[model samples]
Target: MIETYSIWNLHGEQVDHASSSNAPRVDNVKPIVDPNDQVMGIIQDVFPFASTNINQEGEDDVPTPIDSAEFEQYKKLLKNVNQELYPGCESFSVLTAIVELMHGKIKYRMSNLCFDYFLGVFKRMLPTDNCLPKDHKHAQKMLHGLGLGYEKIHACKNNCMLFYKEHETLDTCPICNESRFKMTSQNRTTKIPQKVMRYLPLKPRLQRLYMSTHTATDMR
Candidate 1:
């Protein structure tokens, strides 16, 4: 029976056990275990190359983090605005207040849904007096321009589904069989309905609000 021994070796370190004649003629014998307690094979010795250790020699450079106080203030402002705008009320004052708050805050980016809600609030808050503020007039002008564009695009082609480019030719109207035709920018010639133009202001007003908010820090 041959005397056997088990030993643990560190990674990449060579172990030699064949120095003596009585140590068993094992050449490059490496540790191997089987399901049964048996020696399985011999393996070549391998060593890993040494590398320099990196030393971090300075104070940890980390940013001064935002404290809970600032975060709480933001949350409180957001909550207050949400409360003022909620329940879907038709009050321009509340909507304007919300818009003002959102404009002041960097977190809230304007969107189409927000614009629609703002417009709804404005419509509800529109005064019986014909006179309007300069801002309101500007907003209205932007809306009217968009409305006119929509109308022009919708007019030349009977159906909104028809591609804008297809409207340029008098060959045939995709929506209706009318041979009469007119062309506008980008080869668009379809005639959009007047009714659809009425809603164009809704998008433009929202766009104006967003633009105004981003362009100026102060709402004035």
Candidate 2:
């Protein structure tokens, strides 16, 4: 049989029309992979005339090494993070401290969930350190002018459905028959929601661009 190949995207969707005349562009296209899909090899076009490792005599093909002095700067940042560790510390603070402390000392294991979790802790920590007015307060103390609003919606504990529109007054999840909250000591269920989702408004987010001096210039 003749040799055959397939192209795919990050979502594991087959790319039927990914042909390109440029070899460099083809190399930049990453193959999409699905968890269950078997991968034979990466899908990219290679030009017969293209050269990769033909180092010219007078020209340097290797990249310059990182400066040894720059490592000290990173070391100092870690010391600062290590100084802020405390009991009952938020995950964000703990992770930030660990990352800063381990900078250059070890490989950083950064991920989306890790970063987002700590970011929330960092934001919460910032507001507690100052006594600025509620309207003037921001986690970074830099975006005091920025404003955002979110709506909290009641959601099922099992995540089977959302109590929206016709189900606003629902006290129990229809599918699971689970109470909206636990029947604790003082009926705390009524005081606090069990599962809540914040709906960030898009209109205000768009408007914030024009309001912020840092982004206003770019928006214009």
Candidate 3:
């Protein structure tokens, strides 16, 4: 990796800067999905503005910068960030609990069952004064309320392709032709994919980055 440095001749102070090779790079371009536009169609359905680039007149296709008014709308949507988990709960808010739980899960590599158990225990300990979720389901619902819900996209077990758009009703992988649903004696009627992928929407998350004053300033 290449590196660059600046030195003050008089004071003998030196500062180092990363060269192009060493500097961190972020991919800003939209990802290319299925050639047939199936995945892109699904994404556009969820977020109508996701694929919007050109204006109503179909002018140049480019990213439309968010103005101050648009930013205010996003702020209004996320105004409940400081909402308390329960009435009179000052130590922990809904957002705080969610963040802490997520951090704990990642830091300790906690499983879903383990997370559920801990949440249940915390709920019992706090009694009626706390609104800690009873399990992962409730926590997920809370996230949904805050516009952060994840999408469950069924996928082929053989890593062939996702079941979406034109392939939405297909029972098998288009490429491998493998059975999509696993064999189950108990729930034979209920069709379940052999593998599932969780997709978290990025629009609200991007809006969240501009919610805070410091972060918003940096973003600008």
Worst lDDT 10-window in candidate 3 = 34-43
Each prediction's Cα lDDT score? 0.37, 0.46, 0.65
Give the winner by TM-score: 2 or 3.
3
Model 1 quality (TM-score): 0.19
Candidate 3 has an lDDT of 0.65
lDDT of 1 by residue, 149-218 (tens): 3333333244434323655443555556643444446656564332122225466455444444243354
Runs of candidate 1 exceeding 4 Å displacement: 1-137, 141-152, 155-163, 169-175, 179-220
Q: Is candidate 1 or candidate 3 better by lDDT?
A: 3
Tell me how many residue pairs clash in candidate 3: 0
TM values, all candidates: 0.19, 0.33, 0.51
Better of 2 and 3 by lDDT: 3
lDDT of 2 by residue, 1-220 (tens): 3244333355677565636324445246677643111110100001111123346686646643435543343333333333333444433332243333233223567454555565555547754642221221222232111124579888888898888889889889888987776566774545455788788988877666664444668986
lDDT of 1: 0.37
The TM-score that candidate 3 achieves is 0.51
Residue 162 lDDT in candidate 3 = 95
Q: What does each candidate score in C-alpha RMSD?
A: 26.8, 20.9, 14.4
